[model samples]
Target: MQLRSALVTGAGRRIGREIAIALAQGGADVVLHAHTSSGDETRRAVQQHGRRAWVIRGDLSSRRNVQRIAREALEKTGKIDILINNAAVFFPTPISALTAQEWHTFRQTNISAPFFLSVLIGRQMYQQGQGKIIFLGDWSGRRPSRNFLPYCVSKAGVSALTQALAKAFAPHVQVNEVAPGPVLLPEDYGPEQQEELRTRTPLQRFGSPYDIARTVRFLVESGDFVTGASYVVDGGWLAQGHDGSGTSL
Candidate 1:
């Protein structure tokens, strides 16, 4: 099936940008979402790929905003064949400093937003008879490290959400997740820390955003029998039993 259009959240930078571009290269027009950034650069990149691009801005933490995002995206693009839930927030809480507000923020952005988007958009896809929904998850959801409790839990929710949506939209829409291990480390990570992480991975290096993006494309374009699956593109970090903790860094 040739994906005609895709909606990618947090497309302003990093992994989200790469996914947007990859979809464009796959011959799909793109709807780019950014919380704060204008996403002009990503828009231009998509256009360069000869695919149409639209920018939509909204704070995913609010249900109202998420509704607006879905409404506006559909309004701008007559139909959406793909939805990539790539927007997320990560921070160190260390358990000791974990606050209700921080927890709420993580849940709202990391889990709730995606869930709402999937439901709203998935319904349309179901009516249309086919659609693809891919969530950008984290490897930490499997074995969460210390100091990032809320973020990890939220990601875990994504795993469940993927399955639930797969069942809910069964026989029509396909829902899956791409959990990245150590593609882009935090900016504060030191060189030594980076090297340690790289050495721990079986591949002995960090995976690129393209790794995740290509996997997403495969699911949308080729994985006809796939649904409720989690693709980990971590370069074997999880295989080594490494704890992806950020507090120590």
Candidate 2:
């Protein structure tokens, strides 16, 4: 049987990298898309799995670039069996300091880019009669955060987009989302802050990137009946309220 092809956006580092490699391990050729072109390690990791890996670099925040990426991936791989919208921008946007530029940038990358990418790729999947599209969402989307207002709102949009596409794509394509919580702490966060996050999590621990990656793998490979669902891989963080005493420096 011929292998399938998958395209993973923002797949140069962190959770995106793991998702790309996991898909390759599942016998799929991968088109790894990186914005700002900093995913050499991710490309190497996918190639190490003995699957063909193509690196396509572009800023998904731009509609032209988004279209170019979809076109290039299909051109190189011949088919797109999976599309993972994993690239996103996370930043603090307290209501006081929020600016129009900040909101536009965040919305364009986090919401508009993913929606457009899904529409284009989904059309291809519909024609193919079988494909999967996974969006990387966040727990903050369900439970809003005071500081990261725009990012949380953007992810909430992602969650809704997942459901909308699932219905629109129907029996031909499967659309779903994996929402992760505190899997990887920001670079400046200290041990005390990490402990606080762990305490809030009912599981009392942080989740690894691999944990999110595995959930995505399952949805893509084994989740035939699953569509329009948001899988929470938050180590139970949403089970409790947020206790804000940490400092991000």
Candidate 3:
């Protein structure tokens, strides 16, 4: 088999950008998806790597858009061998201030989009007899960080979806989740908060988006034997436990 093509959502920037470039470098053509980000730079990167790259923009908040993406992408480029659900809505939604719309947005973006995208692509892969699906989860999702309640809940759902879909897709499509710890900190993020993440990590260091991207490439190239498993690239933050003893995610 000549290498396969991949669809990586949220490929406009950050980890998504890194993953798209990595996949292209590893010999996979790419379909870059994003809500607002045009992914022009990422597309150029993929093309520079000598793989064909296509850009598809749509808001993940709309179920229709999510559903349309798989069909549209496949229509443009047949049989996506890899699907990476990397687009997500993350924010601190406290109970006192969280609203119904915010809750719905979290679920729709973080969980619903990944689930439906997997379903659409998995069906195609099933017909073709193979595929790889990866969902971007968060360490906080498994551990439940304070303030970021809904985002965590949504990611927790992603973890659940990965395991369930791995079984559902069965012998054809291998599904997995990549739960990142503190990969890329925003430029404005407080130094004090950075220390908190580093202190909590057993590796005693912050991770990079490249770390997550490398893991994504690994899963895509790992072949069809692995499924229903979540690879946490969190520098061992999760191994400590979530009962509020060591450090909050």
Candidate 4:
């Protein structure tokens, strides 16, 4: 089935951009959300697929801003058939350096924003009788890297949120998550670190953004019986189990 319309957070670049474009390609008009970066590139990409596109800019860190984004998207599109919670902040927070402000930042942006957006839009979808919500999670959320404690914890909240929302919106709107692993390394990651992660993957390679986008497309376009499930697109890394290398995701 072709998706009517979708709101993709952080659609300005990386995996979010790819997901937006892929949804457009699959015949879904897209609502592109961007905060720090312009959504023009993704909007253009969506338009190239001959689907309608709208750019909504706002900071996900603020609940009011998130509410505004939902309101604006619904007003513009009439209704959103798909919602992709892909916007998040990732940074290393060493044990000794961790701060309350850091935890709050991660909680607000990574979890709180998505939670608000999900319930607000999710209720609408529930009332309408059909919709799909997909959250972009991290493999580290399951097997955390000690280096990014807050990030992992917030994402783990996402996993629980998915299950709760699925039950809340049950039998009407479908809710799920897609956890990606090593698809896009942080810009600050040095060559040795990058190589360590790449070689450690069971697939012996990194995944492309499209790998994640495609899984999202499946949940929206094809997975009618699927919900409350977390699909990990990590090149079999999760399956490898602890290789005793003490490798942290």
The RMSD of every model to the true structure, in order and in angstroms, is 1.3, 2.0, 1.8, 1.5
State, as a TM-score between 0 and 1, how close model 1 is to the true structure: 0.97
Deviation of model 2 at 236, angstroms: 0.9
Q: Compute each candidate's TM-score over C-alphas.
A: 0.97, 0.95, 0.94, 0.96
Write candidate 2's Cα lDDT for 42-133 as tens digits.
88888888989989999877999999999999999888989999999987777899999998988999999999999998998899898999
Instruction: Kindly report which residue stretches of model 4 are placed more than 4 angstroms away from their true locations once superposed.
Output: 243-248
The parts of candidate 3 lying over 4 Å away from their true place are 1-3, 242-249
Ten-residue stretch with the least lDDT total in model 4: 240-249
- Residue 98, model 2: lDDT of 94
For residues 174-198, what per-residue lDDT tens digits would candidate 3 score against the true structure?
8999999888875567878788867
Q: Write the per-residue lDDT of candidate 4 for residues 168-187, one digit (tens) a residue.
A: 89999999999998899888
Clashing pairs in 2: none
* Regions of model 1 farther than 4 Å from truth: 245-249
Between candidates 2 and 4, the one scoring higher on TM-score is 4
Q: Can you rank all candidates by lDDT, best first?
A: 4, 1, 2, 3
Q: Model-by-model lDDT, in order?
A: 0.91, 0.88, 0.86, 0.91
Q: Worst 10-residue stretch by lDDT in candidate 2?
A: 240-249
